[model samples]
Target: MGIGDVSKRVLLGRKLRSSQLGETLLPKRIALPVFASDALSSVAYAPDEIFIMLAVAGASAYAWSWKIGLLVALVMLTVVASYRQTVHAYPSGGGDYEVATVNLGRNAGITVGSALLVDYVLTVAVSISSASQYAAGAIPALVGHEATAAVVAVALLAAVNLRGVRESGTFFAVPTYLFMLAILGMCGYGVMRLLAGDLPEAESADLVIEPAAGWEGPLGQVALFFLLARAFSSGCAALTGVEAISNGVPAFRKPKSTNAATTLLLLGLIAISMMMSVIVLAKQMSIRYVDPHELDRLRTAGGDALPEGYEQHPVISQIAAGVFDHFPPGFYFVVTVTGVILVLAANTAFNGFPVLGSILAQDGLAPRSLGSRGDRLAYSNGIVFLAVLSMLLIWIFDAETTKLIQLYIVGVFVSFNLSQLGMIRHWTRHLRTERDPAARRKMVRSRAINTFGLTLTAVVLAVVLLTKFIAGAWITIIAMLVFFLVMRAIGKHYEEVELELAADEQDKVMPTRVHAIVLTSKLHKPTLRALAFAKATRPNVLEAVYVDIDSRATNQMLREWDERRLDVPLKVLHSPYREVVRPIVDYALEIRRANPRGVVAVFIPEYVVGRWWEQLLHNQTALRLKGRLLFAPGVMVTSVPYQLESSQAARDRRRRDDHRVKAGDLRRGRVVRDDDQNQVGR
Candidate 1:
């Protein structure tokens, strides 16, 4: 094969037949990491965000960290329970978009789709950006180049995901599991130490935090309420990926809905555990975390500023250090896995976005190209599109996790609130006709759960807008609106095109006559071949036409035509401006104008070359001529290819490549033995 093909094969492995799609279905073991990584990995930074928001009021506000964590966890649990009903109701993988569209209306569905699409892109950006920060801490060389490093990490993750869902999941499953183990193990050990009354304090435990300007004294109830609301809004980022499982139920194996529900439950419980543990441990260990940019707020006990260049570690990292103080290896393992899992967390978005994109495409709301699977049975276009948009975001935000975090969770919650509302409507609509009392009772229960979810999420969404709209969430809202408008325009265009392309009775009418013209520059083999092919069609009129840019060459060609004594007539059009394509185009258009009810067929000979550079050397005039003729009414343009000698090499290379044995070819009985080939030749 060619170099490009070989490289792709090496990168993505062998292509699989469409029938092998069932083989790619993931079991519960693999599906857990594939879809839950984003929610699980949020524990790494969710607590940090909680502390950053609380730090505005200084360390005194840190006492509320555990309370906010529980609040976020409670929202997550309700969301998970709500989506369990969603998967059972809509197992087709449309997730929120499908639910909203089918229950609410077209506009509602499009809103959910747009919201999810924006959120998925932000997921990749936020996850990879966070990972880059961790990498910068571990490797000092990456401190100033986190954006560049993040872009590269996004590209690598996209490449791995392009190799098909099952394969990418298998690759990422290990790190995701390791992260879970490391965090849980660390939390368990830290709690044990606390029970034994021997838990060491965090490295920054002694540092005193000074309240920001205007907060020098005790705060009123109003100020305290606002502060806690903002902190809770920020902490709610833990709920961002809870809906991914509903969006990806089709990727699961047998009993897809059940497996997906189980996975969602597992994700919610584990995420809540890890998140609550980190917060409680941070509080117990007196982890003095603050906004990385505002580290100056932290003061030494003697009322001295922290030394310049004193880096503040993340909440989890500080807790890991204090819990594993006696064993450096434990600290390193926890830190390493945390960083790796953050990067892999974007895989959840990579899987969800493309499937949702495909669904939109199938519904004519997105470009049709996004619906087609690549050679590896993955939605390659959607993956690449997500990667590019995320890289742009990373570059624009300079890969600062704190800055990007402000734009996070807005879209997901938009989808979450709409999805829960739609689910409530879904059960209500179905209960009207579901006759069986047992089934009715179950539907009523599901409706109640969804109703409760809707209430909680609706409140969260309002709080998010109130607290974060000025903090960067406005950008996400604007993005969702743009996506909605664009998809609506696409759907309208597809509908119009469908109507315009529908066949009618007039389409069956034949042309009155066929007027054929073979474009010729010289009396050579290619020109002669075109003329012969045109005559064989038995048109009502046939002739050879030439554009005479030079009189000397025109006369020489005329002399050759006369010498050959050809039967077909040759007509020459003189061009004073030395333009070749315009004259041919004008002549064809004139003919078309003269015969509105007839057809004008223009055959042009084009050279086919194998080498890429050879293409630039030929076919410039013919290409332009054909392009111009295509727009003329009642005119048909055809290219009669004359293959150059170099083209044989391309054909031979393709033949050889087609015969080569690929992985699984022998097992599938696609390989031809040497003896069998010899017998066929004999």
Candidate 2:
């Protein structure tokens, strides 16, 4: 009906009724990629990190790669199992924050919330960064501009996520699955080659790696253990998105927890297998991977640097290149799918952030706006917020996965450890109240699972802290602290406001007297009408108050009032400050303090016009005066609308179009229809 509506439909497509949300409920087939992409996608960069840590002390430390990967996998499996319990026990979608807060106290919950929030933002940043790298690999022209490409990828991700979750998920599902297939397919072929003793080394295998400043020549146990710990910490990146399924349980259909748990288990198995296999293949193939910028440090046996601009491909890139050494198309396919999967990985955060935001809003920790569902049954505000925050981070970090990944898993593990501890406490408390033997037995078993998860994750959290605190873990710690404080402040403010504005016995008490004031700028029809309306209320005292900034105008008004002999007295207050609202508010407050039990009713005449710009020209002062007066104790500010000639047209248009489009609708064009997802919002 309007240009505003027209633009929205163009960007976000047609508007659907709020009742059709169920139509967006994900089936298992689509749901897997929607939520699992983050953890699954981490394999692309996680292995590279592990190799980097190992190569720090030279390649001799490389033997620890598989051991660290196995340890990380074991921890991941524990985390997944624990979260399966989390989803089942708490499926309202608050995830770790809700569980920790409910069981471990508000402090723990806030910690988890901050961690989760930070993690979600990084999920977008890291995923988009990885996608950019993959994009560069696929297209040589994008080489030096990978950071720019990464940022563009993030921008594209933000746009798609703005549409809504189910829609975005469906769109991302294909690439995520393709990535899984590619990696799994690569690993399977590498296994066959290994069996046949014919696998080729990576193209860059001949390039030597010079260790960082500290490790010149190290067979020392201390250096080896340190390298192993660092590698283990780096491999921990694989666990970054494991908690998403727990956070996103409600996104599933009926039996939400069961569906979510199954997804989690499948994610763990697939991720562990894919990751371990890739790491093994890379080592066996003698993939000469190093930090791209550090490639000049690498030298061949003859002591010559491998050549300038020697583009070292990523772990997957190396594997893909080696596996498809002769078959160029297979390498291209792997690169293409890897790029798609990395970009799509952000969808996991898109799904989780909105759901968590809705829960936070309900608990009065976030803005009430997040509590409302959009036409697509999604928490649209939350989704957009996540997108914008992630985009900002992506831009700031230049979408370099290596740089962005520094801020990655610390938050996720913070949530993981806290959530598990909370679940353990939850089981303990539940067991105390349980009378039924079978349910009690189940609780005991769950407690055991959670306890194991807590131990494992706590160790991982400690390892991450010890190994990475200086390597950007502190950034995440600071972020969690910031989020925790913010949530607490929001909660406090909401509580205070709720208490101050609360309707109760005290609020119902009537004032001893009512003193009504009519604001008059001139003796026009509108001012006269407001005067008459104020008098009809029959207050104990009634006065027409005018701010006398202009003496000539005030004199003319006084003379007219005197000649007319109006029923209510006219009081003109001189404002040397020439302030419109301040003088009126001070006058009202003086009357209130003099008679503390009396109520002040301030009535201002306001102009209502049809066109948008026309309305801005009139009644600005009256609106300001009314706004100021409302803050006074025992004061009621009312706007008496004087309809302009154009107002009728505006009203007719409003009558023809009635819809409440809150946030996130500015981009959508107006094409309203009954969409399935919108049904949930109804």
Candidate 1: the clashing residue pairs are none
| Model 1 global lDDT (CA atoms, 0 to 1) | 0.92
- Cα lDDT over the full model 2: 0.83
Tens-digit lDDT string for candidate 1 (1-682) = 7788889989988888999888889999999999999999999888988998898898999989999998998899999999999999999999999999998899999999999999999999999999998898888999899999999999999999999999999999999999999999999999999999999999999999988888778989999988999999999999888888998998999899999999999999999999999999999999887788888899999989988789888888899999999999999999999999999999999999999999999999999999999888889999999999999999999998888899999999989888988999898988999999999999999999999999999999999999999989999999999999999999999999999999999999999999999999888989999988998999999989988888899999999999999999998989999998888888887887888899999999989998888999999988888778878888899899999889998998888767766667666777656744531110
Off by over 4 Å in 2: 14-18, 133-156, 432-441, 502-504, 559-565, 654-682
How far out, in Å, is residue 235 in model 1? 0.8
Q: What TM-score would each prediction reach against the true structure?
A: 0.97, 0.90
lDDT of 2 by residue, 181-205 (tens): 8999989998998999889988767
Please name the candidate that would achieve the greatest lDDT relative to the true structure. Answer: 1
Worst 10 residues of 2 by lDDT: 673-682
lDDT per model, in order?
A: 0.92, 0.83
